[model samples]
Target: MPANLHAILSASSAERWLNCTAAPRYEEQFPETTSEYAEEGRLTHSICELKVLKKFTTAINQRTYTNRLNKLKKDTRYAEEMERTSDIYLEHLTEKAMGYDAPPLVNAEVKVDLTDYIPEGFGTCDCVMIGGDTLDITDYKHGKGVPVSAVNNPQMRLYALGALIKYEPFYGGMIKNVRTTIIQPRAMSEDDRITSETLSVAELKAWGESIKPIAQKAYSGFGEFKSGEHCRFCRGRAQCRARSETYTALEDFKDALLPTPENLAQVEQDGQDGIPTPAVLTNAEIGDLLTRGKSILAWYNDLENYALGAVLKGEDIPGWKAVAGRSNRTFTDQDAALASVIASGYDEALVYERKPKTLTALESLMGKKEFAEKIGAFIIKPPGKPTLAPASDKREPYNTATADFTGVTQEVLF
Candidate 1:
């Protein structure tokens, strides 16, 4: 899924629906700037799942449960404000956070794959508590503030789809009364939010139909490339010509005009009450005009960080306090751990080296090693000066291939 222009710009659900349907192009586009910790949250989710599934199937607690309230608290390298929300999820999973129909769990594996058609897609959900036919799919949101509902969450719906497919053979009946839920760990905050929604059978079928063309197009050719907001996650973000031009066009026309809502009548005897004003403009000028009217904080870019630096000890000379930065501890250092191992009193060397450094090193690594994983350039199909790299090539990621590409279907992830 590298820089194939078609893959880069066309990955969004909206983009998929828009390209096939008669939906008119919006003058504006959204770019999904997914965060680093969001990526880490995904990784942690995978790790947690490995542990949970191992435990669920083997009926033994494999992963050592730690006193650390959250994962990052136990392992400090990944802690940033970006990870604070993930920590919240950890707390929720470990039963340190709050209320749950069942004890809070982390990375509780739930999957959904719309396999009814070709190029079928599947997503593993973050967490959930099984409650009969009502399977609550709680996707972790590392963003700050109150948890948002997973209601109508595409990922959750997809998870439900996967669950249905999985359970059909085992449960053998219609898999009636399946439901989903989303759990946000943090208490209500200005920035942290979680939302959930349930999907009707009609809705899921409709969604399947809606995404059919996108999957098909992704499989068939890189042609029909278009640009819009969702391209923020595009691996070719820095150099996508279509994305650049689309954003540039929107910015250029930012001051065009907007159709404003007009007030119908004047204020009555009420002193404070006033009549609403009606002004009209297009999407362009509306931004400027609306900026002057109210103090609506649509995007809270500032809530990106929360951790404050602790006092620096003996290291700093000026305007600094004498204290160590907030840090974490490990169970390996505990006398109790040593005593427990001694009590079991078996081979000390094997017990001591149970978790070798190499194993932990691999666990701590970032990203997949595949070269073909890089963000690729976006372009239309029937590639012109196309990079001739093999589809299975793992040397470079995305469309980062040095070979020049022309529009072609092979450029995308089928």
Candidate 2:
């Protein structure tokens, strides 16, 4: 086995590095750190890979699965939720594989090389299955905060490009189309949980050619700095001068467009009759401001974190200083407190009310197959609330008229 190579323009960071060419080099100054959520994701991915491998290769046994899971469960963040979610991801792959006329060639944790399209670009596809004329690549997302879609997703496209390059020699002309799927088990709704996009080999290759120059420029650290939603996860976002300048421009532009003193006086006088003139903005100005607003808040948050971190480390931040946040009271000894409360003629139920296990926990306890067979019909999933997202996001526009509502209404009596 060989050690995995880290690419300067990794496929996972393609959206960020490709857009902000200076990000890769700038981000290199910061040390890589993983969060508890990231660790949980890694553990879940390991379980998914093992389960898939065991399906094809019998060398892996139940004991191997149990040992790996037992080790993962030792981590404080690990829970039955991970196992349930992993089962959903694995079941999706199995279902997709069964749809093929012939048995599909399934590969898990497959290394993909995208150096052809991006400079040293590479990533591991969670699941890749080839059958007849289709190559399906699936990526697992463990995060529940945001729903991921496969339509026009650069990461999946890059992975597909890499897979095509590696497997083309073996499959040749038999592979006509590539299908990319994103399985986000924690998505709010079932429909949003799975998203797939298909493209012909010619289309995918053309896209690869389109990004070659951008990747090369990023590789040489010679492209202009650009920022957008992609900066959300960029390590150098807080220190990026270009992003700061972009945000500053918004304020400067707004100040320059402020109404004159005479106009303000005229509006005040005109509003004496209870009708005031409304401030009007041109469509172009509105669009520009809207675009800037989307990123300004995120940039401000990043700046706050950076400044606070520096202040906490005893680094001078000019006018800022770290202060202890407000704290809440907690029991000094929970078990002893509970025992004393029970001894004082209080019922145990008053101290602790037992609740039913969550749907995920119950499913994990009873086994997904058995649970579904017995009580799947009781599951009811409500539609998710509409949220504002960038136009580039793949989610469909939410229609307000189609929203479901309960007939019962309560009137507030003030």
Candidate 3:
């Protein structure tokens, strides 16, 4: 309900909003806007605009609701909006905003559920012009960061999927003949900066299908990756097993470190300067060591409040956060314990732990030096897929009608 909040509304949601049809199997417990990609802004804006135009006696666009503008960069502002919906909302509000309003409920969160597996995939466009073949889907973004292009954005594509899914059922399979774009209202200080791009029905479908596998994999790995970045804002982050690793990484490094500024500086300098290997350590090895530590630290920092916290009244408060990490916190008392064991005449070999085999040894196991030049040393593995994608442009293709700005865009073909 507030502006600048990053609610996760996705394509599945867009489909449900426009159709005015909530799915029977669909049970959304959180606020309607809590979805990863939501479409509520459009609904709110549409209603506000309608009220302003219909009430001739109303001197002010008595928009009863307000929204908190988005704070993050690359929120829904882009070019195409100026070409279409900008005029519509502006005319409706007939107002100049001071800051963002949070109470005004709208269909701003629009997503195309390319994956039919999710029920919210079925969606209606934000605004529809009646008595014509033209269909325009308008979306609003409140964030303050750089406006990302709606073209090739998965969020927009998912919204597209929802549009097609909802519209095609009644209009028949041909869901084409249109333009799509992001309309950033504040960008130009006039209307929205619109990205004038067109998407074929076929292309939209293809893009939607392309992302289905990715979504499926995430759903599958939800358990394994539950604790890391996923846990940061996850609805179920508190009890996830994957998040447990985040805790482990954090705990391992939360040592009461004795800061050795000089020692650390020398080690880091040696690594960067590429000092030759001495009997003790080499610069190259130092760099590698630093990198490994960074990697481990990153994994450890993935844990949120549970692993990193600053308490006031023995309770955690929002905003004032803390950082913690995982590092090998060896028990110093171990030397004393070891000495007692030696006193008992235990073999030194019994005290030693087995070390993991070096990667070079694994390579040697896979290849023989006899024909090492000709044999493959090791099989390569690709890195994992990235987690996040950009926000979507919530626009559908429509012929640029220099038509009456006063004309309606939503038409009931039915």
Leading candidate by TM-score: 2
After superposition on all C-alphas, the RMSD of every candidate to the true structure, in Å, is 22.9, 5.3, 27.6
Query: lDDT per prediction?
Result: 0.44, 0.82, 0.41
Q: Which stretches of candidate 3 lie over 4 Å from their true place?
A: 1-9, 12-124, 128-135, 146-148, 169-174, 187-193, 220-414
Task: Count the clashes in each prediction.
Answer: 72, 0, 71
How far does residue 196 in candidate 3 sit from its true spot (Å)? 5.1
lDDT (tens digit, per residue) of candidate 3 on 1-414: 123223223452322222212221122332232432223344334443443333322333434322221221134532333223435344332321212242221233233333373322333344322112323344445322445455545545565556566566766644454344455544522223554345777776676666555444433422123222222333333334444554455544423232245556776876755323334544544554554464345444544434353352355655655445478868779989888897899988898777866544543444334335553444322222323221232433333352322133322211
360-407: candidate 2 lDDT, tens digit per residue = 778779987899999998765544577766676555787665444411
lDDT of 1 by residue, 120-169 (tens): 35556666544333444556654343244455455566666666665557
**In candidate 3, residue 168 scores what lDDT?**
64
Highest lDDT among the candidates is held by which one? 2
